[model samples]
Each structure stands twice: as C-alpha cells, then as structure tokens.
Target: MVLPPPSHSRPSGALARRAVLLGTAAWCVGATGCSGGAKSPAAGIAPAASAPRTPSAASSSASASPSAPGTPSASGPAASAGPGGALPRARPWQPGPGEIQPEVKVAAVRLVEALGTWSRGQGTDRAAADRAAALGIPEALAAQLAVRAGSLRPHADAAVVRVIDAQYGGILSDTASVLVVCDQPTLAGAAVRPGGTTVDVRLSRTSDGWEVTALHPAAPGPAEALGPMAREVLAQSRIELPPASVADIRSGAVHDSVLRAMLQLAGSHRMSISVVRSGHPLDVFGTDHPSDHPLGRAFDVWRIDGHAVVDPASSRTLISAFMRAAAAAGSYNVGGPIQLTGGATANQFFSDDTHHDHVHVGFTA
Candidate 1:
C-alpha cells in the first residue's frame, strides 16, 4: 500500500483567517457553549466538577467462588439472539437512590458504554477497539482490550451489565470510580471468560460530563473473581473505593484476612454500608501516625445499613455491635464514636473526635 505525499498547501490569507478565528473564540467566551468546552492538557479525560454525596441503593444476585459451580443463565431476553447473531440489548445505567451525584452519573454512563461494547456479542477485535475508542475509553485501558479481544470468538448471545457499586472522593477536587459487574453466560453455565464480571472504572468530571480516565482488570491475565458472599456486600452495600483499592485487589495487595472479615460482617448485618477509605494514601488530617489504609490493611466505614455513623441512639447500637463484630473477625484495631472495653482488650478500641463521623476497622498481617 503506497501513501500519498505530504503536500504543504494553504489557502490565500490563511494567517488573516487565523486572527479571525481567535477573535471569534474571544467573544464566544462571553456567550454560551463555546468557551465551556475548554480542554485540560494534562488530564485530557474530563473536566472538573462537584459530585455531592447521596444515599445508595442497589439489588443484585451473588456471584459464586471459582470452585463453586455456576448457575446456568436461564432463557431470557439476554439469551435471545439479535441480528447477525448479536447479543441482546443490555440495559444502560440509571441513577438509583443514592447515586444522584452529577459527576457519578457521568462516570457510570461512560463505564457502561465502555464495558457494554467491549463485551458485547458478535464483533471482531477491530470492531471492539473501534467501539471502545468511540465510547472514550482511555488508551491506557483500550490498548489492553484490543489485544485480548483479538483472540476471542464473537458471542452467540448478548451480555448483561449490572452496576455493582460506585465511589466518589477527592481532596480539593472531584473524582470518582464506578464498579460494573457483567456476565455473558454460555449454555454450559460458565462465564464468557472466568473473572470477566468485575470492572472498576475511573473518571473525573469535565465541562461536558464525566470522562473515564482508567479501568481495572485493564491488562489481563485473569481478573479476580468475587465469591458469592463478597458479591452480596458489593451489590447491596456502599463500599466506596478508589482505583488504588481496585488495583490492590487485582495485584494481591489486599490480605485475605481483611477481605474475609469484611464479608463476614456484611452477611451478618444484612444492610449496605459505606467504606469511606481503602487501599489509598494515608489521609492524615494533622500529622498523626500514617494510616493503614494505604497498605490495604485497613478500611473505614462511614455509613452502615443506610444509616450515617454519626446518627444517634438507634444508629449507635448498630455501630457498636458492628465494631465488636469487626474485633471478633480478627480486626486488631477499631475506632469510632462509641468506645468499648474488656478482656480480648481495651487498647484495641479508641474514641476520638476525628472518628466521630465513622468507624475505622484495621487489621494486622
């Protein structure tokens, strides 16, 4: 294939036209739409904006462990073949209950588009790549998908995506990550590929909307599968986390003991809760000891079963019981508004103003 020459051609008065374009932009700033589309050179993904917190709610079935047998995907709209034997129409994400923040919604939409197309049935790798790119998946993640998609055969059925969870947080900035769990069941009842269900998507707000900056399980050998018990917590709870937390799970940075304790706690409680921090930097307010969160050895719960930690009386009893449960489950340290005492130990629990709003659960080893 021969290429065309690089012809340096120009129209007359090109320089004068450049001046006119600049003038147009200048006045447009005072007007609507034009100046609003300003781009960030470094973070070319999305513009900055606020994502206020709201109550969270979700409903989903539990996913099983690796050794656990998969339940067959029953005949349904998802199993039906469309034109060209394409997968069925997967549902798009919509804000439910607490996910009403503007920035969060944008992130969720972009994530759905990216994964929804990447895992859609019946498309060549090239087609998948094109679809992902069109949906604004960052090159960091898209490059990875292109290689993986190249080997797979197109699907005989469409896939389904469920919004498992979402987390939004930052220091003097607006940032978020949305967790989408998907599946394309085969007649044999196995996943399209094992560990393909979980995806942690990163995004930041732009003037236009939330733009995805990265995605987890991005470069893959295999994704970590969340067992049935773990999925229950994710589906019903507000375990908000940053990309770093997702990376921890991917790279085996988080300890199994910590994970085990969390699942045990969730199952007993039967209510969704908020994880304010996990596997990220030590967000020490005023030069205290470095926190365990950055090491994936600790997690803080700010909300439990749809109740804020700071809430009084009825909420207090729940928080107190949960803290004890954390201790019995091998948490070496726990902190919150309500302090506890007695044998297994008193030093293990602490009460302070900083913790007035949430319960901090920490683990050793």
Candidate 2:
C-alpha cells in the first residue's frame, strides 16, 4: 500500500522541549549506569558482537554445532592461543530475555548461520544440507534449504555471518516470523569485503520447540525510475541501508513521509537503517493491527552517528536527539529505548524491551 506525501511542517515548541528532556534523561542514565551495560561489537571484524552472557530458555533448546570441519567452539582452546595461533570462535547469536518467544527466534537465527557461514574452500553445493544435518533439521526441510542456498553466489572463499539483531516480524501461538539482520565478512585471497542481508524466517511451533519451516530472503522488487525525493535519499552518503531497503526505495514502495524524515535526520547524523518495508513484520508482533512498516510508513534505525543503538557505550544523548528529531520531522509515532514523558498526544512516544536496540519512526499518512 502506498501513502501520499505528507506536508513539511515544522515541529512545535513543546515537542522541541521534549526532545531536550529525552536527551538529558539519556545522559543521566548513561552516567549513572542505570541502563543495562554491554560493549559494542567492533565493526568489519571477524566474530561480530559477543552474545549475551546469560543464556535464555531458547538457547538451551537450539544448540550450536560446527559450521564446518575444524570449526572451534566458543569455549575451545582458541581462547588461550598464542600470537600465531587460531582465534577464538565467534560466539553463537542468542535472543535477549525481552524478545518475544526467544526460542522461536533462536531456531531461525541458527538456520541462517548454518546456511550463510562456511569454511574456506568448502564446496557451496552441499553445504546447506550438510550444515542443516549438523543442526538436526529434518531431511525434507534440509533439501528445501539446499535449493534455496544453491542460488546464493559465493563471493569469497570463506564467510562468517554476524547477526546485528533479530526481531519479531510477527508471532502467534503456533507460528512466528523472525527478521534476522546480519552482515557477513568474506575472506578472499588476502582481502575481506563486507556483505549481509535481512531474512524473513518462517517457523512453526512443535511439541519440542519452534522449528524453521521456510526462508524468505528480501527481494527489493524491480528497478524503476523513482521520485526525486526517493532518488535523493538513495544517494545520501550519511544514510546507510541494507540492499533490500535500497531496493524498497528504488521500487517506490516506501512513503514520502518516511523518506522526508530520513533526509531531515541525515542532515544532522549518520544513520544505518535495518528495515524499511520489505523485511519487517506486516502486523505488529502478536497483534492483528497492521504495522506502518509493511504499509511503507515506517523505518527502523539500528545505528546513529556510528554508535549502535544496542550498545551500552553509545551516547544516549545522540539516540534521544535522533528520536525526537524523527517526531519533529512529521512522525506521528516514535519509539526507542528511552520512554519520554510528554508527547503531543498519547502513545506518541513509547519504549519496550523489544525496542531497546533500535529506534522506530512511524507515520500516519
């Protein structure tokens, strides 16, 4: 569904003041260590962010296995290795407690990691089935995944996938959809190039736990002439997006309201968008109401000015400022880690454990 462009209206004085208050609150919370503390993962490096130390019920349900021969475990000897030795294995990605149906999310992430990651010189042909077998996935499902994996072009000799974040696209008692946001750095000859994609993983609940049923990689749609505003956003250097999001904009599926807000925010900070429309939940997680995202009226930002919104070390002031600026840019609904007190209307500003890692800007029109 396409939405019409919105008017370019200036923010009210009250909203501007609210932005300041939000920033101040973030600063105080950061200084006092009131927020949960965790280190940000180093960018463009092998073995992305470390998984949370505390294990959830889901982690116990879906365990990790070697992606290929010679792969090391997280607790293996690489930890005590000398300068010329093997590096520590990348920790498996896990869902936080706040995530809805943590076990379901884990199942989806594991399958992606199995499919996307492999050892050097490992033949890509049978890797998907082999890795899926290692994870105890059923034979029929394994074959299906193999067909899907066969189409992926191997860009490098070796690859490691690091999940940026996993969010619920939709959830129900017997089914769920997980959007796994990740990036892969591939080793080719002596160089590493950055790459990744967002996947819409479908799952079904079983007596044991949630099991993956299918995988839907983002298809940004056909390339075509876009509106001037869309073209401008696509060319903006400060605004980073995944391939699918780039396609979403190019497809002209996203609303002008979202694009305008993005441009306004880019004027002040560099932002990395995780989802625009193609990879998001069609409905609010576990709800019947349609989400602004699938309607092309919303966008999710994972990073602002180089600091990850999920990182404890990231500046609260920056995130808060960005969130407020989004509202001022014409967003009727803005959500992030910080829950601001005053808003032009009820439910205009909100916070939830699920949103602790990114800011959501939503438009009505």
Candidate 3:
C-alpha cells in the first residue's frame, strides 16, 4: 500500500490531470515526474468523503470517547474579505525537473495543516480566524473550523498527519498541482485508526510565491503499507533517498512484492537499507548495465543484523545466510560481500568492491 504524499488542490473526483488542466504536462505512474493520478482541479475546495469529519452532536462515536466533541454549536464565526481584496498574483514560480521549489512546499504543508484546524487548538473563534488570515487562508473557512471544535474532540496531536511523500499533480506556466501523502496515525476519532491520506493540492503562481487555490482527494493508487517494523526501520535505519524516492515508497507506487520482500528482511534481521536508486537516472553512477532499483524492483542492504558488510570481523555466516534468505523470498538477483560457491546458479550471486559494504537484492516481476 502506498499513498502519494499529501497536498491540496481544487476538489474534483474520478478525472485525469489532463481532464483537470488542459494543455499541461501529462501525469505518469512514477512520482519522479508525472500527473496521471488524481481528480482534476475544481473552482473550490470540498471535504474528502473518506476523510474524518468533525463529529456532530448526533454522532460522537470513535475508538476513544470524544473529550469534547461537537462544532462550537453556539455561534457562527465572522467572515472576512472576499474576492473584494486582491488575491495573489496570477503568475509566479515555475520549477525545473528535480528542483525543490520552496513555494510549492510551503503551500503543500499549509494545506494539510489547515485541515487540522480546531476551535480547541486556537481556543477561540478569533484565534482560528487570526491564524487562517496569517496563512493566507479564507476567513470563512477558519470560522467554520473554529466553531467545529468540540470539548471532547481530540487535539491536533491526537491525529497528526505527517506528509511523508510528495509529487507533482501537474504543472503549467502559472498554475501547478501537487499530490502529497500523509500518514495519519491518530485521526480525530479513535475508530479512525492509523492510515494514509493523500491530498491533491492545486496552486497558482503568485507574486510572493505559490498559494493554494483548491484541494481534494487523490485518485486510487498504491497506499502507504508500512507495517510496524517497516515504519521503525524507515525511522531508525540508515536509509537515505532523493526527494522523489520517499514519495515513491510512501505513495505505494513502488512494486508491492519487492517492497514486501525488503520489509520482511528488515523485520527479521533489522537490516538497514542503504540504496534504492538503481532504476532512475541517478542509477548510471557506477555501472554501465541497466539497474533494477530505478524500477522499484530492488533495494540494497548496507548492514545486516547489526553487522556491516565491510567489517572484516563481521561473521560470514550472517551475510551468507541473509543472501540465501533474500533468494528464498523470490529475488532473482542477490549481490553482497560474500560469494557462495554452491546451491546457486552461477549468475545468481556476486561479490565485488562496488557492493563490498552492502547487499543488493533485485526482484523481477
């Protein structure tokens, strides 16, 4: 399961990026650069049906009893400046491939944050409105959120949405769309449980930067399927990646079978994955042949059960055994520091200085 990292754009459902924005770049399956998935941008925002809504008095049900649930039912928040006040510029930042555009990032972060709004967090109607204005959000939306905060409702901390992955929803000269995948370990209600939520954010270039114009849910795609051990390894292990890589995994855009094999290895032996860039453009670094990592079909393990492949004193049995295990898990190619002489095909395993410190496992599917 992999959900694209989170973002917000206009709310439209069951449409292609092409359908959303005509004459823009087409989306692809890979997060590296595409916009094939997700609904088209709409003129306004809408609440995600799958997303948890602030409970009403009639339904306070959740895994945990709501502490103080219900919309501020007593009063309506004041609205503020409308299209009357000038909005941001019509044209602004345009990023190139592999670039980290700050404007886009800023809009992406704020979009998710805006959803976590609560009367409780701000403590008053005025407080929520103040924050929304500061973030360049519409005043009416802030008031709506402020009045929705119930005394028994969980705090923002109870259900934190951390955006772990991001991708381009679509790009144009002045307008852009972003897809962000977030892991919501604690949603408002106890029954919500922990899971992934993808936010499709539409942004328009502005004089200062990018500002979100709309938001909606992502189209059906791989969902972030990390289990406890996989999550732990991603947190504690030495794995490092380029911006697109995390989004790839977090979105569940990578091959599921391969990811499962890697996760299983990590869970059993506490392996630390060192690399997974083999299938992308960056894979051209050390070898001439095409690599599987770019295809999301392979991963490299730098340490096994706490033993480094490069350590002279590291036990050979551990490395060899791990390689065998990888093979058993359906990997067609396994490379590491230790070379086996028997019980394997000649081309099945390899050892060289290039992989002296890591074990590379490649799956074919």
Higher-scoring candidate on lDDT, 1 or 3:
3
lDDT of 3: 0.42
Which regions of candidate 3 deviate over 4 angstroms?
Answer: 1-33, 37-50, 53-99, 117-131, 140-158, 165-167, 170-172, 185-196, 206-208, 218-365
The sequence of per-residue lDDT tens digits that candidate 3 reaches over residues 83-135 is: 22311111111222222353464455444543433322342456644554455
Q: Distance from true position, residue 327, model 3, in Å?
A: 18
Error of 1 at 304 (Å): 6.6
Model 2 residue 328 lDDT score: 92
Worst 10 residues of 2 by lDDT: 31-40
Candidate 2, backbone clash total? 0
- Highest lDDT: give the candidate number: 2
Candidate 2 local lDDT, 199-245, one digit each (tens): 76666555555556666555444557889999898788888776556
The root-mean-square deviation over C-alpha atoms between each candidate and the true structure, in angstroms, is: 16.0, 14.8, 16.1
